[model samples]
Target: MLESLYIENFAIINQIQIDFHSGMTVLTGETGAGKSIIIDAIGQLLGQRTQPNFVKENRDYAYIEGVFTSNEKINTLLDEMHIPSDTQLIVSKKITKDGKSSIKINYRSTTQMLLKTVMSNLVDIHSQFETHQLFKQSYHLQVLDDYCGKKLSILKEKYFNNFNQYKKLEKEYKQLKNEELSDEQYDFYLSQKNEIDELHLDDFDEEEFIKERNELNNFEKNAKHISQYKNIMDSSKGMMSLFKDGLNELASIDSSKIQDLHDQLYDAYYSIEGINDDIYDYLQLSNFSEERYNEVQDTYFKLNKLKRKYGASIENILDFRAELDKKIQYFENRESVISTLESKLKTNQENAFKIALDISKLRQENALILENEVKEILKDLYLPQVDFKFQFEKTNLTENGMDSVCIVVSTNVGQVAKPLQKIASGGELSRIMLAIKTACQHNENNTIIFDEADTGVSGKVAESIGKIMKEISKNQQVICITHLAQVACFANHHLQISKQLKSNDTNVKITILSDEDSIIELAKMISGKEITEQSIAHAKQLKKNNV
Candidate 1:
């Protein structure tokens, strides 16, 4: 049960703290007196998103905290999250002006995900807008599962685990099938692979061949240049012969003066003679045959073609060849693998279907019990001839199972039951929700907040709704925001919210009323801005008679 709520610097109501009790508690106020703001603050504590406007006009942050009596389920969660808690669990939310927020439980920092897990077991706030959830068919599964309790949940987890495995394998099988090559395509790939394998080009040095080809292509020009060079350095008519003859003449005149000059010329003659001999050898051994050139040219052209088609380098070509080998192997042995996958898929589908059938059986059994209980509750809520049916239809297997559950109802007797969304009026929807709430009983020890759940209900029906809430509070705690005198009069604790302008700022104040004060408040609710002596008397008797 929720023990207290303390809100500071929140919208229009600065620093308001409200204490709660174990039974039915009602908050009554005039329109625009910040009653909904209090609910919104509780919502923020429950892990709902808060807007920036929730902060007061001049405040930089909004803080909301609540104290709750921890139950076994909640304490177990806190232990799993390593959060320390005593008998009482204090949860707080702090939101800054920049929209950053933090949550703390028992003075230990916690995350929003953890807070939601812990608080969900403590509070179940049902606002007016949540009634639309009744119209959605998908929500029915959750409702049924909640009714079925732990037995259905264990089976549901097992079914989904198997279903996921089945889907994964099915996807893999389809991918492999799409990747399988046809006969003609396989043959084409085989031919390409054989062509590359037969080449034996891995050991051939293309760089050395390219250098040799260049030298041979310029052989004639090179031979001509070497012959001219030999002529210029020859012994008979070359520059070296002239230098030798001049050296001999200079030596015959002044041997000492010409000795250094003759020595230098001798060295020059020997150097030129050695280079001429090497040139003659090269000319004698040069090979420039057309057949060899043609062979080299053909091989170079073929290698370039392979480079463009396969890859720019030998390593790349080798890698592509390896990939082709894998593809070929797959094509050769695909039939056996496909057969295995198909057999596995069949087994998986059977298992999933079997589990779905089991789940459906359970739901069908629970549906009967649910139908009877809903009809019984609605009868007391002023729907005497309401025909309530739990309709089930088979659908393809989803994460939720293979059955679709819908609530069908008829407001009058002898009328065929149709979909609730199609036939139920607004008032009927409200009562139907209340009846489900009463039947499911999912609110054990939970602080259930009903924001005007008594709308579209009046008189005896309103009184019945109030009585139901009061009874529910015996096991759980209920906080109701209502305008109905019938509902508010049954409050174990009645708090009035009134707005006042203090220091030029709107102030929302909550006052816990006395017995006499509650009668006056009820009278105002009954007469609406014109409370009379008779209205007060009626309010007094209304409270008395209900007691």
Candidate 2:
């Protein structure tokens, strides 16, 4: 359960701290008293999307934090995430005017998605808008699936996988069948295939070919430089000839110092000669020729043209060539491949159908139970004559399954049941939605918030709605924002929200009303600003009866 909430600079609420208790707690005040603002603040704590306008008029940012008593499931999740688990959990959110937001769980910075994951089952808030979703037939299937929970989810996973495989094989089969080529098309593909096969692309290296082509393009300039270098090093009047003549003259000296100098010159002369020999061998191996250069240029042009027509790279070209081979092969042996795909598609369809039938069976069984429970709850909410049922239709395999569900209802006796969107009035819809909510309540300890869920209800119907909420609170926490005095009398705790002007700025304030104060507030709700003796007595009697 939520222990307390602290909000700062959120909407018109400059700053406020409100404590929540387990049981039915109702927030009541005059219109525009900021009751919905408080709900929005709690939504932020639950990781709902925030808007820039959420920040106060001149405030830089909006902040909201909630302290909750940890449950076993939450603690287990925290352990998995390597976060320390304690009895109390602190969740906070901050939104700035610049459209930036941050969330933290126990002061540890986390992402909005993680916050939502942690808080998803901990609190369930149903606003008036969510009640309208019942009109959508799609939502009806979702509701039934949610009621089935993990049993249906696992079956759905298997069906979805099988269905996807079937679709893939079906698409491949269609494409292959459509690829029947005429004689002219077959000839064109065969020629293209032969041309690519002659290239031996498996051993082709485009990078190495380009490198060799660049070297050949600069051959004339390099050849001229090589000729000049050979003349300077190996010509008769060049460095090598001059050094040899000097070494020969030095060898004739007989003095000891001259012998030492001659030995050093001998070593240096041979080192230079070895380097010259290596250069001569390299020049001989080059063998640059005009024929070879022209051959490389022709290959380069052919490769570029292939790239333009088939692909932009060697890998893509090879892929295109492989596809051409398949097309040619299929034209010659089309029946065999088509037969194989049909067999696989039939097997896949059977497997998917089996799982979908199992899912539908489970849904049919659970639908009966859910329908009975909804009718029972509706009877308590003063719709005793209501008839409700699930209408299921077989559909093509979709991600969800092959079942299409619609909820139909008839609120009056002797009336034929029709689709909910067609037959149900606003007040009747509210009661039906409440019945569904009660029937579909999960076993988890969730804090359920009703933001004017009793909007189109009043009189004894409103009182019954209050009673149902109070009964629900016996297991889970229930917070309601209501304007009806009949509902307010049943709250275990009553909070009065009122707007006050401070420093020429509107601010929202909340007060935990005492027993006497609650009675006065109920009287105001009953009489609408002119609380009379009769209204006060009526409020007292209503409170006494509920107690």
Candidate 3:
């Protein structure tokens, strides 16, 4: 339920706060009292789209905030917002002159659409303009469904699930069974995969192999210029013998000083010996030949060929091979897949039919009850012979289910109840709309805001509509914007919208009336601009009688 609303700088509303409760809180005022402006503000706070022109002249910004209390479902939504419910949810909207609107729920930044969805469950603003989806031609089916309640809803859910499941298998079956793959593309992929698989290459460190191959190439080029250092040193008795001779000569000069000189020379000789052994070993291992070079070159060329046909690297080529294998296997079992999917699709269709049949049956039952209830409501409104019925059309299986339902009505006695869309009179439309609301108000949770639903109605009919709105208030909040004093007279919580010329501007305002204020206002509505004593007395008598 909506607890309260605070509006500021919102089109002549400068600032107004209204505390709301669980019954019908009616707004009654003279023409152009800015009642619609109040409704519009509430709409904004509830996440309804707003027009820029709604901002008051010279005002930089407009703000509206709504406070709501929720149930279990609303609590779950609060969890998504990451905010504690704390028994109250506040939604606020600020529209600036720059055409920017900032939306917030419980002070958390939010989008208008999100806040609107949340608020929808909490408050339903039924406007004065007979703009209800139920009244509109396009919304006939939805109204029937709502009246059917959970009976139809559950069946519809089951039907839709089956329908969707069938669609899934049907789509896959179509893709696999109906597609014609190109022969060239298939052969290309198959050859690529087979070629990569045939490589039989060792999973050695490729980086290391390349390094070794480069080293081999270098050794092959420099082999002739290299010499066996140890063989030369031994055969010619070159540096080794000379170094030994120098060490002995140093030893003879001074025993201690010569010993140090010999030790240094000995160390140099040992280092030279190690270097010679390494050079000899490397030369021995070089086995480089033109034939081996050809082998390496051919392997590089083969790998490159695979890369162009498949991918840039060995790892990527391997992945592509895996994909091709899966696709080919799918084609191999294409018949089996189609067979399985066809069975599933058939089974799903059967399930959907059963569910949709169940839903249709329940709607048929509920439709009878709803029609009777509407007839009763209409009887009270002085149309005892009104013909009303719920009409159903069967459509192809849809997510919303197989039943296409609508509300049908005929104002005159013995007339066939055609679809509500075909009825043209405003009075009949208004009455039938109220009749439907009266029938299903028990299931709806949001506040019922009716703006001039009583238009083109008067006398006992007007009085009955007021009584019906008042009755609706017992279960849900009812806000009726009305031109008729009779309807306004029945409001338990009456608010009035009136306008005045101020500072060369027309300003509108709303006021929630006390009983005394209501009577005077009702009299003004009853008697027009000139309120005579007799009309005021009549207004007084009407209130007295209702009380």
Candidate 4:
């Protein structure tokens, strides 16, 4: 509940603090005496945005603050924001001349959006303008959903899970049927992976392999050049025999130096023998076929193409092939899974519809009960001949089910109760709103603030509205701004807004009225410029009767 509201440089309230406790608190004054200024200050602390116009002539800013007793949900949230509650929470708002707004909760700086979200749970102020929420179809559905409590909460969770599950399956099924791979692209990928896989080609260096092949292809020409060059050294027909004879002649010298030279010549002859055998093998092996050359050239091109398609490396190409294979396999499996989920989803949708229908059926019955309650309250508001009814029609199947709501009203009997918007007088709208607030005020967790709810109402009608506010105050704190003496008489606490001239300026101030003061104010409100002994007596009786 709101503990107190503090305002500075807010409209006519230069500086004011109104301490409030639980129950009916009434603010009354002559028109334009700043009753709304106080309420607007509280609204600002509830995260209403403001401009520099609200600031005083000499001040650079307007400050509004409210203190609220903590509840469990708000406490948990404050702890999350690291705000210290210390039993009472102080939410303060500051607006600078530049229209910049800042907020603080429990003295720790905060955001307006966060403040508004948290404060909503703590107060449900129902001014006359907002009391027709239940008369709107969507608000009626929300009310039923909230009233259904855990049953509706559980169903909502179940429905969402089912919705996501169905959407996932549907998405994959669509992708599966529309899996796009043109024939040309498929052929390209197939050929690339196939070429690399066939290459039983183990670790071979490309540069070295090309060089070796080139040398082998020129082996015959190289052999002829080496032979012709060796002919210059020997100048004989049998070159090998000539070379051996020259070695034998050298060996015939018997000195130690000659012996060394002869052994070196023998080793040279053996090396030549090995070289001769190697050359013969090369001559035979170097015979290359056009088909073999073409095969090597084709394979090199194929391997290079595979490298370019997948990546710049053979290893990355292999990895890409494996990943694509896995994706294809997953998509194939998803196809079957979606078929299974589709059947399950169809069944769940049917069941969900039935559950929603059952909830709507209950609301249909409850609507009748609610209509009678409204009629009873309206009759007390001196609308005995008025027609009011809760009309329920079928609507689309929504998350909360299918019940359209209409609040129908007629000013007199047999005049036909048209939809509320068409027939309700401004006074009747205010009274009808009061009736609804009184009916549901006991259930919601918000405070009700009435801004001149009793305006234009008089006599018995004014008394009934006052009594209704009193009854609502039994369970909820109701702050009403009023001019009616009958309305002021029923307050658990009375605050009177009065104006004074000071320092060449007009100022408005609010005071909490004592029992005697309340009766006097009530008398003043009833008789206007005159306070009569009879008016006081009537005010006293009205107060006593309200008690």
Candidate 5:
């Protein structure tokens, strides 16, 4: 449920913070007192698109924030998103004049799409426009499924998975049956297979081959450098020979210091001699032949050619080769492969059909319960004569399980049942929407906001609508905006929205009404700008009767 909301520089609302509570709350004011503006701000928090004009006239940006108490479902969702779970969730949105916007959940930056997904589980906002959704045939099926709840959801998921598998097998079978390789095509595929098989690519290392080829190309230059270094170190007059002569001369000295110098020089001379021996070993092993180089070049060219014809890399080429083997096998054993796929497709289709039938059976059973519930709720909404039924048609297997359900209704006695969109008046539609909402209420702690959904009806019907909302509030939170005193009188909490002029700018102000103030507001709603004694008495009576 929405615990509170803060709006700043949003349209005419410069700055305002409104705290909300559980149960049915009503917002009432004259037209254009920013009632719709408040709803729009809430919409922004729900991830609706924002416009530049939503910002205050001279302000650079607009901001809206909503705080909601967390439920198990909300916490589970937060866990999935890797956000820290808390007792309260703070959702905020900021929109700049350049049409840029940013959204945050618990002060962590998030995308608008993700915000919409999370907020959908937390709040449901229905406006007058949403009431018209009943007229859409697609929406009828969803409503029926929602009413059916978890049993039908589980069945639908099963059918969806099975149907997708069936379709995949069916598609594969058709493709295999349609592909008839000609004699020339078969020969071509065989030739390609033989070419790939001859390469013996399983043990090939292209990178190592390239490295060896580069070494061969520069072998002469490397050999010349090695030869020069060996001559400088191993010649009779070279550093190794001179060092040995110096060591001999030092050894001939009779002094103790001379003997230590001779020992040091002797160790250094042997180290240089070891390096010379290593260079000679390398010269013996570093033989390069023109024939080996030519052979490598030919192999490289062939590999490049195969890459250009089949794939961009060796791994991709190998994958393509595997696919070629499949095609070749299919050509050779066409009848056997087709027979196997046909059998698998048949089995899959039968299984999918069984699940779809189970789904359709459950839907038919639940439809009757939903119809009865809608009828009972309509009676309370003052549409007692209205007849409600579900019209079901068998459809080809689909993700929703081969059921096409439409809502048929008769608004008056003796009237033939017709599609709801054709026969229902605007007032009847509103009442029917309310009935559906009440009948389909689930056991989730989500806030429901009705933005003047009570329009186009008044008197007892309006009062009944308010009573229904109040009953819904027993399970979850409900907030409504209305002009009728009949509906506003039932609110457990009342907020009065009015425009105030400050510094030559019009801003929205919300006042949480006390019991007496609520009555005064109701009286004003009933008597149009003047609260007469009779209207005050009527407001007081209305509140008393609802209690």
Candidate 6:
């Protein structure tokens, strides 16, 4: 239940704090007294979208916050969402002049989605416009499911999971069956595989082979140059012999001076002799084989062809081959795989149907109870001859199940019930929504606000609507914004909203009325601006009778 609400700089409501309690509380005011402003502020706390105009004129920002008493369900949800809190939940909203808004749950900043999730367990605001939701068939199923409680919910969870698995397997089976290859295609793939497998090219590195082939191109020219150098050094009067003769002559001329020169000449002669021997060895080793060259060329070309067919690199080509192997294997065992998947799908289908059947039974039983209760409530709302029923039809499997629910109604006796959309007026729809809310008993121990729920009814019917709201308050908090005195007189707590002209500015004020003040407010509602003795007496009598 909501403990209190504090709003500042919101529209004409400059600053106000309203204390809420567990029972029916009604906010009654004249037209243009800013009653809906309070409802809008509460809606923002529930994470509804806000506009820039929501802030009061000349104010930079607007602030609204609600303090709610928490329960175990709310605490558990907050813990799961990592939101910090104590025994109370504080939901606040700030709207700036720039049309940007921020929401906070327990002073921890949160997104609108999270705030909505939290508030859903805390309050339900049934604005006047939401009565249209009663005409939707899907909404009917949802309401029915809520009324059925955890039994249907558990079965629905299992059914949806099984349905998802069945869909996945069906998709896989169809894709594999579509990919079955013909005999000719299989033979073509086999031939390509053989061509690549026969090469044995994995043992060879193409880069290294290219390097050796290029080196072979330089072999002949290199050998010719080495032969010329060797012939020069090995001649009798060549460099080696000349060096040897010089060393001997220099040694004989001067023993000490020529010893260093003789050592240098000896080193030069041996270096030239070593070069000649190495060149000769290299020339002998340069014998090239045409057969090996042809073999290397063939293997390199075959590998390049395979690379072009598959990918640019050896690793990519190998991965492609693995994929091909999977495809071939799948087609080879196509019938067996399909049969297996079909069996699994059948089992899943059976399981889904069995669970759906159980869920349907629960819904059918609950629908009858709900329908009778709604009819009883509607009877008190001055809809005495109204016929109400829950119509269920078989539909294809959906996330919910194989049932589609529609609320059927008939306004007159002896008439067949039809879908509410075809029969219910705005007033009837509002009463129906109230009936459902009262019957379902969803969201217990939380605030349920009706923003002008008594829009299109008057007289005793309006009083009856107020009585139903009061009864609903036995289990939850009810806050109603209404204009009818018949409804406002029945509130356990009465709040009167009034507008005043203060210093050339329009201001709104809310006062929690005492019994005497409540009677005066009701009299004003009964007689408009002119409150007379008769209206006051009538208002007092209305309150007295309800008490």
Candidate 2 C-alpha lDDT tens digits along 1-547: 7889999999999999999999889999988999999999999888888899999999999999999888988988877776677888899999999979998888888887888888875887888888889989998988888888788889898899999998988887789887668999999999888777766788998899999888987776777787898899889999889988998898888788988998898898899888878777666788687898898898888788778988998898899998897788788888876888899999998999899999999999999999999999998898999999999999988777789999998878899989988999888888898899888887556798999999888899999998888888888999999999899899999999999997899999899999999999999999989999999999999999985
lDDT by candidate, in order shown:
0.85, 0.88, 0.76, 0.74, 0.89, 0.85
Summarize candidate 5's per-residue lDDT along 1-547 as a digit string, tens digits.
8899999999999999999999999999999999989999999988888899999989999999999998888889888998888999999999999989999999999998888888887888878888889889999999898888889889888878889998987886777678888999889988887777677788898889889988987885777888888788778898777777878788888999888877877887887678778877786776787699788878888888889998998898898888777677788898888888788888888888998898888888989998999999999999999999999999988888888989999999999999988999988998898888889888656899999988899999999998999899999899999999999998999999999997889999999999999999999999989789999999999999985
TM-score for each of the candidates: 0.71, 0.71, 0.73, 0.67, 0.80, 0.73
Report the lDDT of model 4 for residue 478: 81
What is the C-alpha lDDT profile of model 3 across 1-547, one tens digit per residue? 6788888878877777888877777777766678778888887877777777767778999888888776677778879877566567888899987768998887888887778777766776654355446556447667678777776777777777788898887776677676666778678767766777676544735576577668667876666445654545755577777777877777677677768778887898889878877876777775677787776667667878877977898787777877677557556676675677788888888898888788878878888888899899989887787788877789987776677776677878778887665763767767777787788776344677786788788988998988888888887777778888777777677777778787787766667788998898889889887989998998888788654
Global local distance difference test of model 6: 0.85
What local lDDT does model 6 show for residue 260?
Answer: 80
- Please write out the lDDT profile of model 1 over residues 385-439, one tens digit for every residue: 9988778999998888899998889998888899888999988998888888878
- Report lDDT (Cα) of residue 87, candidate 5: 90
Clashing pairs in 2: none
TM-score of 4: 0.67
RMSD of each: 14.9, 7.9, 10.7, 17.2, 6.1, 12.6
Candidate 6, residues 501-522, lDDT tens digits: the string is 9888888898999999999999
Q: On residues 35-134, what C-alpha lDDT tens digit does candidate 4 reach at each position?
A: 8878877888777767777776677888888888777778888887777766677889888877898899988888888888878767765566574563
Off by over 4 Å in 2: 68-90, 104-118, 181-333, 530-537
Instruction: Report the lDDT of model 4 for residue 416.
Output: 80
Clashes of each: 0, 0, 10, 2, 0, 0
- Kindly report which residue stretches of model 6 are placed more than 4 angstroms away from their true locations once superposed: 181-329
Question: How does candidate 5 fare on TM-score?
Answer: 0.80
